[model samples]
Target: MGISKHSIETLKQTLDILDVIGSVVELKKSGSNYVACCPFHDEKTPSFVVSPVKGFYHCYGCGVGGDAIKFLMEYEKLSFVESVEKIAAIMNFTLEYETSYEKKPDFALLDEVMRFYQKNLLNHKPSLDYLASRCVANSSIEKFALGYCGASFETIKFLNAKGLNKTEALEYGVIGKDSVWEYARFSDRIIFPIHSPSGKVVGFGGRTMSGANAKYINSPQSKIFNKSKLLYGYYIAKDKIYKQKKIIVCEGYLDVIMLHQAGFDYAVATLGTALTKDHLPLLAKGEPKVILSYDGDKAGINAAFKAAKILAASGKDGGVVIFANGMDPADMVANKQINELSDMFANPVPFVDFILQHIAKNYDLNNPLQKEKALAESTQFLHTLSPVLQEEYKPTLAHLLSLPIHLIGSKRLPQHNPLTFTTPTQEIAESVLIKTLLEKPEWIDFALEYIDISLFVYKRAEFTKLVANEHQDSALIALMINERIRPINDLPSLKEHLRLFITQAYTQILSQIPHYTGMNLQEKSILMKEIKTKILQLKKGELLPYVSSSTF
Candidate 1:
């Protein structure tokens, strides 16, 4: 429901910001206001300031300044409406709506429908037996409010008896239609009720226990239900999440329940889709860390990579945990692998390391072509991060690839010709001479004697590393060089190729330099002469003298 402006004003007026915020953060009086260490970011000293008179907070350390609603929304990952409702509930105040909401299915009706499913589970022995077979305790079932939907029109009948017509049932996804007629949306399956952040049952997810082609089905999007915005078990797990300051994001409803039953009460899962940006706000609220516990399948692996990228780019503190031996969180718990599961939760892989390893696995680092492709792909992802994060990681990735730090951002770095306009084939050709030299490490001195390392354009760091005989892997070093075969016996052919590649690099560098209109005529003449001299040297087939020191 949409709240009125008057209700919001009254809400702020009636409640004290210090009181509400103080519940979660310990605050000491600092003059007219109170202060605490900022919850939004890491800091040693108190920087988060709160003003009871203003009814707002400002974290000078993180530059996050907002009102009570904004603070609750960010701190708890609650939606605007959810935040207001929470505050209203705390203040024992009823909210007033300015605009009338449409007469849609209310939570009372949803609650009644949930009761029908729960009753069905009680009578259905087979579903209960199935839960037992999966090691779900009776207490766990009751705590999760688990239910079953039989393969019949019982849900439709139950709702119809309570004055909810078939149209409303269809709208709520309680029923779906085929070519012939309509049937219950979920049947012959264990049902899991998905709740709103405020603890109201808004939708359902049903998993087939029999031989059904579709393993699971969820309620379609509706006024109350959006799978993207909701997390399974989140409402129930919110208290534990707040207490533990951590949340385990898994891939299935059972994974969440099993984890919770195993005493990890802060576990939650995405409704039916892979974790998306819509879920981040909710996940960010309860803690600084979120553990993505995905299955060890190909799909799960890909999803983990994507989830890692999203979390890293958004600057969220989290890690990805993929189960080994094809086991999921539920499987691990079922098999009594508590130690392994606990260890993963206790020490999740850091996000940067996880993504780098994932990208590296996609290519054969032994193969020059694949290694180059992998590094290019990895560097592109790194560029999406903030500058501070990007710089912090550059040296680490460079050291991993045995390349120069400059090469990590070679495409963006001004010293090297911007590779933005170069075709992949052109870039590969440019890297061939370097790759061949890396394979014949002794040949690096001869090549360096002729061409300056800075003018090598691509893979300058890897080239320099090879020349210096740094600790390296042959296969990874090969990938940084072009994967093309080298004819070492044909010195003339090799020299011709090297000459052409170096010429092209200089030509590109010259073309890319901007003409400075601010330069005086004498300075412009000197610049033009310098550029022409290099072109003339290239044209005369004479190797230009080393122009600058090594870039990497």
Candidate 2:
């Protein structure tokens, strides 16, 4: 059994494909459809088109076309069911799953294991005392579902007797087996159960209270758990993140928990992995600013620097909070330095400024060679910023380097152009047709008569919708007018564009006629004759096509 077809169809019906695609890509209405640079590949000029009427998208450059679900599957790397669940979350739709086929281990079982760990922590006095020494409050412990496991084999026996599958338990990293013995993997350690965004416990993270080889160990990546994608405490911190429009990302689970307890509920942690590209979409939800809270140590500083670059490249606004030597968020809270931590969060250095400071810290300004090297490195990094931001920070960088602002270039350094165009003139013609109907909805019907609907490479759905509604959609018209770089201003402009589009369409079709290697001599001759006649009429200053409908 699989996900119900009805659910997928219902989801497709409720979702606007344009909205989903627009959330990731900066889409502008060029004509009947929305256009943006294809996210599937890097290109400056837009070849991606989203059609709301058709409820799908097509990228002429990369040739990736799909409905909403397909787009999610490719963009987010989610499986079919995962994509459905993601969309369901957006639409607030409840999905019902089939029962006949089972996939992966049961999450319900994982919940029971969590309960066992929690109970075990209660009985373990030394672990509780250790937590207390760290200034972990009882309320915070309960709120975060903190737990522990005993070091004895009896714990495994108890779990086995409770009908836990040995394979499943091992898969979740809850238990381990060796040459002739079965043992609990995380014994004598405090357990932090990792919950999914929906609040179901998917895995556990264990920190050693005693001397262990690794100070921290996490559950292996299972079907339900992905360390790279899961942000610690995200399920709990999401609401606070939305309310504040910011997220505090720290280095460890204890940092996140302590920050929350100290009244900064927006903090979360990475699960033993540095921030990655996969984490961006999760962080970008609700469009919140990010603050990286790391230690002052070299590893921490390097991690913070790397994360800041990722944030900048993704166009996210954020900063950094480097905790002082030998101090982390947990240590700060444990020492009752809540006020100082609050101040650090409040006054985080903006990402660009933080990067600038980080770069300058390595080189002495007194040495000419080092100063020049620092300035060169800073200039190259600053070039990655948006044109507006690059301009905004130029003066600050100049003052820091003790150099004139003009020494740093105002424009972005030229880079190689990787994008190539196909039939540039024809694409422009297709764009004009779409852009005209969008700016002046009233002309949709007139354009429909003279221009074949199939001639539109973008905004075909918008064109179809306008025609169906009898050339009326104030919302669509407003969107087009607001989004256009320069809109059609008057009736004469619209008429002129329509004439140009018709001429270009005939010319493009005529050019492509010979490429129809599949056509016989009679078919080729007939198509060429019709196209030649249309071109002659267009050259004669005919404003409209003689043909009533599209023949191609």
Q: What are the per-model C-alpha RMSD values against the true structure? A: 23.3, 9.4
Q: Candidate 2: misplaced stretches above 4 Å? A: 1-3, 9-63, 72-105, 410-552
Q: Estimate each model's TM-score.
A: 0.60, 0.69
Per-residue lDDT over 1-552 for candidate 2, one digit per residue giving the tens place of the 0 to 100 score:
577787678877888775466556655554456666789998776667676665667675676777788889999999988988777765446665676553333576788888888998899898899889888999999999999977758668778789877788888777878898888888878999998776878899999988899989999888668888789999999999999998999999989998899999999999999998768757865678899999898999999998998888666887999988789999999888989988888889888888888888889988999999998888888878777888888898888888888887666644422123345665545555555666566777766666666766655665566567633343233223323224567777766777777777777777887777778888878888877887777677668753422344
Write one digit per residue (lDDT tens) for candidate 1, span 76-132. Answer: 999999999877765546788866653233566667778888999999998898888
lDDT of 1: 0.74
Q: Give me the runs in candidate 1 sitting further than 4 Å from their true place.
A: 1-105, 177-180, 410-552
Worst 10 residues of 1 by lDDT: 411-420
Task: Kindly provide the TM-score of model 2 when superposed on the true structure, using C-alpha atoms.
Answer: 0.69
Each prediction's whole-model lDDT (CA): 0.74, 0.77
| Collision pairs in model 2 | 31-434, 31-435, 32-459, 33-459
lDDT for 425 in candidate 1 is: 49
Each model's backbone clash number:
1, 4
